[model samples]
Target: MIEYFDRGAIVTSSLCAEVMKKMRNEIRKKRQGKLEKVLLFHQDNASAHRSAIAVAAIRDAGFEILKHSPYSLSLAPSNFFLFPRLKENVKEQRFEDNAAVVAAVQEFLGAQDEEFFKKIILSYKKFILKVYYNKCDYVEK
Candidate 1:
């Protein structure tokens, strides 16, 4: 599920669509071809993500795009959880190249278990509840 982009490469609508297709295939394989549960896909409101082609691709992938407000860090689990943990692990470390950096990231992600991912989902749920209780106001960190 880790996708590496080339340095300075722009994320176009086509690229986003392609990645969504790949993600769909990966999710299908993970679910053993039986997706009984609805797939709610979330991404920031980047231009590429909102483009017509990207929206079509997401629909084709059988994923429902979760509504997200612009600049909403409180709703982004990766910002509060995943990336912070990743940064903690890789901080003060020097990698020989992009491959080395990628290897390190792969190692960190691979080390996480189902419980870790479950906790992430749980945290996201909590965040959603907080947002709801706050009447769609800015969620506290």
Candidate 2:
């Protein structure tokens, strides 16, 4: 699900907590209340993500956050995969408003199939191995 924040809105700890709750709820619904597998979440080390409130929310939702290094581009799937594809799709396009931009993003996300996401997850394993073999140094594409 794509959530859009208001223009110029700062992602505070409270907002992060709220978003985490919403994400958990969405996942529960999608799984039809049967969350059999452990939830492993990966996110950038933003201040809000590490804040007490957000951490509590994540724990409350029973999510195990994957360890992420600060400013590590290789660890961010969005940087190496999603965003570039999204940019290529929306490049040279002008949006009238924030809503339009959000719609475009939502459209792009909606167009991706399960295989697309599965491929990303599979690629993440390779990336992790590469990072490990390189002693945590940056792994270029």
Q: Which has the greatest lDDT?
A: 1
List model 2 lDDT by residue over 23-100, tens digit each: 989998899968888898777777898899998999898899776755465576677767878999999999999999
Residue pairs with backbone overlap in model 2: none
Go through the candidates in order and give each one's C-alpha lDDT.
0.84, 0.82
Among the numbered candidates, top TM-score falls to 1
- Stretches of model 1 off by over 4 angstroms after superposition: 133-135
Q: Clash number for every model?
A: 0, 0
Candidate 1 residue pairs in clash (backbone atoms < 3 Å): none
Question: What is candidate 1's lDDT per residue for 1-141, written digit by digit as tens?
Answer: 879987789999999999999999999889895888778887766789899999999999999877775546556667776888899999999988888988999999999999988998888778777776776667676
- Report the Cα lDDT for candidate 2: 0.82
All-Cα superposition RMSD per candidate: 1.7, 2.0
Q: What is the TM-score of each candidate against the true structure?
A: 0.89, 0.86
**TM-score result, candidate 1:** 0.89
Error of model 1, residue 8, in angstroms: 1.3
